[model samples]
Target: MRKSVMTGVGVITAVVFTGGGFAAYNLWNGVTGGTRAAAAQPSTVATPAAKASAIKAPSAEAAAAGAKAFLAAWAKGDFEEAGRLTDRPEAAVAALTAFRTALTPTALTLTPTAERPQAGAPMTFRAEVGLPGAVRVWRYESAVAMVKTGDGGVVVHWDPTVVHPRLGAGKALAIRPVSSSVPSQVVDRKGRPVGAFPSIAAVLDQIEFADDGAQPAGDGTGVVVVGSAGGSGGSEPLFTISASKGAKRQLTLDADLQRVAEAVVKEQSGPASVVAVEPSTGHVLAFANNPAVGQNRAFGGATAPGSTMKVVTAAALLETGLTPDSPVPCPKNTNAGGRLVPNDFTDARLGYTFKDDFAQSCNTAFIEAAQLRLKAGSLPAVAKDVFGLGLVWKTGLSAFDTDIPVETNPEQIALAYVGQGRIRTNALAMASVSATVQSGTFRQPVLVPGKAQPMAARTLSATVLNQLRSMMQRTAQSGTAAKALGSISGAAAKTGTAEVGGQNPNSWITAYRGDLAVAVEVQAGGHGADAAAPAAAKLLQLGNSH
Candidate 1:
């Protein structure tokens, strides 16, 4: 207060001096706040805690819907649809299509259980497909594993089961007896045991009996004696039959001829089936698939008859008053349902008499004579009744259902006359036709040899039969089949080439020597002459020699 009075404040100086510098101290404190008090206030903005993302669990309904759609698509052979439902769509389509093509199911039932949801994961389902009486089911299962993919779906991964582990490594499980009563032994025509009748325990080494246990008989438990002895400790009665137990009798099949035929078939056919059957007796002499054993093209293979079926048309026409000598005008091309039917294989127009047409395998001639000229409506029935083209014979072997797809239209009939329409037959059925003509009656083709039984007697008139035979003879001598039967004496043959979808044709030749009727087929090969006829010639030579 002593010096401040005059410095800067005149009025404040008196108050400041009186207050003993209290005002001045207060102002100084406000300007520079205390650091300690400010630091004591709690932090208003807090640091965020570690965040965790919430995962979604798949719904059972969605998973089930996917599984159902997958199965339906699989059944319909729609691979693409099936794929979309799977986690790995591309892989699923490929695997499913392969399964569909490989497995032929008599019955298929798929039952998918409730979806089992994994913890914080996608849902999954279980399905069981029952394949009863499967030959290689175990192998199939081993090669394939049920797996759920990352996206949430199921698939089968191949894992084949190990074959016979203990008794025989390579061999499959031996047939076993389910009951102790001893099932009747299977015997061949010669009274030989067709195969080993070892007790299931004997072949398999260890077998569990059914709950009923063994049946009681005169001596000990009534187990029918199997193998070399009856349980009675006596030598098993050897029936006077020349057959022995557990022995496979060598068939009459000529192994050398079979090799040649198989080789030729492999060389010529592209994914084709070849079957050589004894037509008169229906004995399947040689059944071979082009690729090898399992392709199943011979009896099961089905294809359009093409012009080769004209042989049946010719026969049908002859049955209905038209003969090889019947004067039927063969135009270069006959109009059929807006499409022109040309004369001969070249699709060229030519004038052919009935015989010329038959020898040349003329489509226009046969069509004009069979469908247009003759009783058109009667052709199918005539084919069924006379030639047996659509007839399903009881060969006691698995066969494709032969059909003459019902044709009510003129175009269809024309196509049928040339074997291009709905008409379909397997090698066995076609051979039966040839055999019927040769034997003057129809005999069921027999694969398991025993006694040949007649399914039906002669359905064609003797005159019709003779005329057909004569025409076939002419075919062998100078027709499309002439070269096939050229060197063979007493061999009457007809060669056929059936056209398929832009594929190499199916060749067929059926011939008979004395009691043996043979039908030879070459698929995806050349004409009947090059493919089927050569095989027939060789077979005829072998049969004649025997």
Candidate 2:
């Protein structure tokens, strides 16, 4: 008898005797080549049809179960066990080991397709592979080819395609640093470069990936998977990866307004900041800081607001039955909790109205009004209840909201009334202050579109709203703000020069025109009319175009 070798896993070799053209059947293990069974009579040779019946094929269910077991083992990092479930154990082990070492995957999930496998067919599955700090999970579909074994069991048919559908023969998977050809970037609402406004660097740093799945720009040091494609033996990128640094994130800031604000603040020799907002929606148009690299004082610093605090003080007085025409005394110096408070200019007039006090920023008038008419907690109550100040403001980023603590000390209350002693605010807060007056309601400021915060429950009465607008208009028309904003029709503003224990005081101005509101602060930049008002005017001047 002569025997031919059938060299394969679980393959059997058949023995043929050349007598009478008949073949004797013998079952021998392909690996061991040991005889298993001899034909009983060694009769005629078996036909091709009969020989095919001798080998039993696995059922479709058996193939699916075997594929599932192999995937489970791979997902669990059990390369050895996974290899044992495959037809070629050594090759499977080597390839799987290489995949793990090269990819360093943090997570892996394999989901079988809804359709079950047919006999001797590939079992399709969805693969979601994850890497550490990757911008997103890499998703693809692959299949598990199954084969029947000699032991009446099914095993995975090993092929490079099982790991990745694109991984052909002689190809290996590897992760390399992402090429700088595609780096993450951000843009303003008008598609301008976000980095152009150096003052908003802090705001940009707080944002991450964009929701839209657009491709990233420029190259980066991020992670990526590179490999050979279609058995070409040439290196090519299979996947680009990165941390959640978005390719392109869009901000709510208007690029035109940002340019104007940056240019305005740049005119200051000392530290300066400005914030602009849309009164109708409370959307932040622009926020800029001079020198561009220091702390985000435009949105976070809580310095005293000087006479700008009178806006809230006036609201408190209006809430307590005082009208804009109500008589108020603005003496050269008045007693406030035994401390002498003086106005910017001595008022010798006998009967000045509440409108005069606000327009002229009379420190004595507001101090005496709060001391005589308002209760101990009235100022903070009004700030929180009506103006939305002193409340948690979710502006989609880090910001210091207004802080007006309830004061029982009459001395502190007197100072706080004129925006001095414990009244702390920033340009963002004061800009919203003007926005509330213009909108007749408190709309929380938002820098990101679709991130608007809940509005305050209380709204300003129409009477109080009209009075505040009229008083601010008068100030812009003839008072401290006239030189900077009076020429612009319908413009309204309030100017302040806050005492910060220095020869040069902090300049502050809050203004609104049409649907826009803005505030400016210049540290040690002299009076508000000279320093902050011009910056605020420029911000409003550009709003007409937007």
Candidate 3:
């Protein structure tokens, strides 16, 4: 036996009893209808069975009403009420939640194309979406299916396609960064094309493609609407909305110096980078990388600075009443923080002056001094308070600021004093370090003119600056950097060789002449003087000529 139930009030056509079962027919002429069961006389037992059926289906007007309520609730952001109007409440709720969360639309509007009843199960509407960095609204046609329920009412059929026609099951909407159209060209300080210099092309690409809108004529970055099953990366872009602000953008780079830097790094045997800064104004004169295709290592590299960190260490000691000529001990190797530390130089002197240790790049002398006289917070404090090492930089480009975390371990602190453990910097930041020592002030470096710069907390004291300059000058004149610096007059420098376990050490050199300060690095280069110093000297020479 089969039984059927009909909803709403309706006209009853007939009722009959057969084979110990009953059948009823519901007939309607467009009004509401319901089914009723009544006992009937057994007159047709063992005869053909009759089936119950409804004569009328829901009208198009009714489906439109149901869709109106659901869409109204959704437009008001009342997702729960909207879900209740759908056939699958749970699925509808989840999809709606995901739609709002993923797109992050600043404004959303859904308007039905026609208010009049439509002769279709799926109702169509215009979906307009707005985003934060987008220049225009994204508009498209979307639809939902209206279905009749067992309760004799209509409901919206829940499906991912209801949210977006192209949206598939288990997929989501997302916004991603696209290259902008405005500021179409990047130029140097003198308005020459920056793309010509392959050495700094990666950096120029980042700035040109950055998603910023601060400049009135710079439209920053473009945005795209994508339907993705995974993260933003590898997503399929469905629509692109481009923005426009300016025609061209200029940087603070000097063309001649940039060419010199590019040429110098090209001659290195391994990966190398050079960054030059103007000491007085904190302008980045030039920055270059040997293989300029991948990462912009000149500004974003995070590696141990080796003995170049002695500049900060020496400053911290100078704050403690130690002068340049103060007598200090330089041992071949000494136990520091439970580890035997040694200097690059083999000769051990009992009364080497502080100047001698700095000029000779003595690791043991610095380790011993820090172990006895300094605390864990001493170096970080001096780095932040004086030279602006760990501050947020707004250089109008992608850059990795120097990171020197405060350490409590004696071993780590000892290593940090000589710039080995837990200390990381880039060529750009090291150049800024030398610039600060040259000018006695920490002027934040800038690539794009008029970008806001972070204020340096304090300037190096006159006494400390003078002594550091004297020691660095001695380094260039008669110490490790002597041959590399050659005849560069009025120059100061410090050389570094950072060990990386099984790999050859990274060679480093930071130096300044007149108003120009430069830093050079050669990855897997054996010694600072042999590799990095020559490049630094060449860049400093070209930079000073400007």
Tens digits of per-residue lDDT for model 1 on 1-546? 000000000000000111111111111111112342332222222211211111233354444344444444444434455445443444444444333222222233232332332333332222222222422111111111234444444433211111001111121111122222222333333344422321111111111112232222112111111222112232222111121223233222334445545665566536544455555555655545565534355566677756556656777777767877776666678766667866445655355568777676776777766655555556566666665555665444456756776666778867877777777776666667677778776666654455334455237788877887787777778888788786666776667777777777777776665655656666666677877777677667766223
Candidate 1: list runs displaced more than 4 Å. 1-264, 347-351, 450-454, 544-546
lDDT of 2 by residue, 1-546 (tens): 111111111112232223222222333222222232321111122222222221455788787777777766665445556667776666666565555445545556666773458786788876666655554555678898877766666778777778777666545566554453323555776777665467865445454333355665545433232333422334445565552355666666788888899899899998999999888888888889887765788888889998888888898898788988999978898877778888777655448899988888888888887777889898888888877888888776678878898877778888998888888889999999999999898888887667747767688789888988999999999989999998988999899889987658999999999999999999998888989998898877777345
> Each model's TM-score, in the order given?
0.57, 0.62, 0.63
Which candidate ranks first by TM-score, i.e. highest?
Answer: 3
Name the better of 1 and 2 by lDDT.
2
Off by over 4 Å in 2: 1-183, 208-219, 222-246, 544-546
**Residue 354's lDDT in candidate 2:** 92
Clashes of each: 15, 10, 8
Q: Per-residue lDDT of 1-546 in model 3, one digit per residue for the tens?
A: 111111000111122223322232222221112211111111111211111221233578777677767776666555556667776665665555555444445666666665634665567766666655654455677787777666576777777777767666545555554444335556677877765678654444356333444443333333333434244334444544443534566788888898889998899887888899998889888899878756788988899989999999999998888888888889899886798888877889878889999888999988888877888899999988888899988887778989998998888899999999889998999999999999999989998887776768887778778989999999999888888885889889999988766699999999999999999999998778989998888876665654
Tell me how candidate 1 scores on lDDT: 0.49
Angstrom error of the Cα, residue 129, model 1: value is 21
State, as a TM-score between 0 and 1, how close model 3 is to the true structure: 0.63
**Between 1 and 3, whose lDDT is larger?**
3
Which residue pairs collide, candidate 2?
A: 135-242, 180-218, 180-219, 181-218, 181-219, 182-217, 182-218, 182-219, 183-217, 183-218
From the highest TM-score down, the ranking of the candidates is: 3, 2, 1
